[model samples]
Target: MSTTVVEVENLSFRYDKRLKENILSNISMTVDQGEWLAVIGPNGSGKSTLAQLLVGLIEADSGKIRIKNTVMDDTSKWKVRRHIGIVFQNPENQFIGTTVQDDVAFSLENLNMPYDEMKFRVDQALDLVGMSSLRHHDPSQLSGGQKQRVAIAGILALKPSILVLDEALVMLDPKSRRELLTVLQNLKRKENISILSITHDMNEAALADRIILLESGKVKNCGTSEQLFVAEPDLEPPFPELLRRELLKRNRNIPNEYMTEEEMVNWLCKSRLTV
Candidate 1:
């Protein structure tokens, strides 16, 4: 049986007391262990607000949030926090330490972790994100993706079961973004960690196991990439899928599952060899 790492039930929130409208209303979702779940929507769709609510950054007006089956309340909020980690949109904003190593060690230090144990975890986390080589480098000297990975490494050191990324890749270049995604993919497979990424990046969302589409503070659609992108003709697919469709229109036979340019190229190469 699969275990649910994070569960939100009938979640709703509102920032202003005077306002009649809620930022998020009647939202419900679950993130299973090791699953990659992407929440996508336009600006002001309550995606960021929902992320904040899940991480206990702000109190929800109505709803329940559970981490690892334990209901989140004031009593268990700290414990619930231990099971989850979050990375924000701005990597520089999350950084406090001057060097890569020090930044990764900051979280463990706050928990009053023993020096030896902290050293071990910091080293382990840096290596996991492929930032060990730049352990001594200043964060200002690192690229945007490298800085984001450092932020993730800080969260990774805590060994949380769930990671919530609130548009963490929005600041990176395309190459760096792809590299970061590869690192995330490896982490998901190797550590079996549940990932909840809230973003407007359709390319990133399409790569996830499931996607939740939010509009006007409500769940507009919820389904897998194929179900949403391939099955729905009215909605536009991601760039890769659009290219794949254009190729198919020209009588080029590409596998239905080959949604990316790289996947299509590899399939074609293998087919040529077999012929």
Candidate 2:
């Protein structure tokens, strides 16, 4: 049975009260435990605002948010925040420690965790993100992807059940993005961390188990990548799906279904052999 880790009900927010338009209006979503849910939309669609609201960085103007059984409000927001960890767009902006190890340990240290337990968590989190070897290296000296990994390790040390990423992979190159995604996939499988990734990148969103499409401060659709594309045909599809469409245009005998990169490669190889 799946558990609901996070739930937002009729949530509405606005930066300014006089604007008369809510930045997010009647937004309701739930993230199940161990599920990877991606929120994708164009700029100014309130995606980032929703991310901030989820972590209690900003209060919603109306409605409620629940992290597990705890309801989010001014009084309980801090307590609710303990179960959620947020990673922002720029890894550099999030760095606070001189070394990767220090960065990962920063959060645990803030909780006044014991030195021994903190050290164990630091080591474990670093290993989870594949940054154990770079523990001694300065975060400034690391690559963009490495720094992001360190950021994630910092969160992992806190052992948050829900992870919120706000355009966290936007700064990475293609190879770096893929590597980071692979790391996240492993974390999802091994640790069963529930991920809520807010991104504009369709390719990244397509990898998620389910996608939430936000438009003009409201959810336009919520479904798997394939279902969302089928519902909103004008939206850009992932690279593999796009390739499949092009092949179909050429009258190639290929299944018109969404595929991951690996699946696409295997299909091409099989087709070539059969031909």
Global lDDT for candidate 2? 0.92
lDDT of 2 by residue, 23-66 (tens): 89999999999999999999999999999999999999999999
Off by over 4 Å in 1: 231-234, 251-263, 270-275
Model 1: which ten-residue window has the lowest total lDDT?
266-275
For every model in order, what is the number of clashing pairs?
0, 0
| Model 2 TM-score on a 0 to 1 scale | 0.97
Itemize residue pairs with steric clashes in candidate 2. Answer: none
Best-fitting candidate, measured by TM-score? 2
Task: Tell me, by lDDT, which candidate is best.
Answer: 2
Superposition error at 93 for model 1 (Å): 1.0
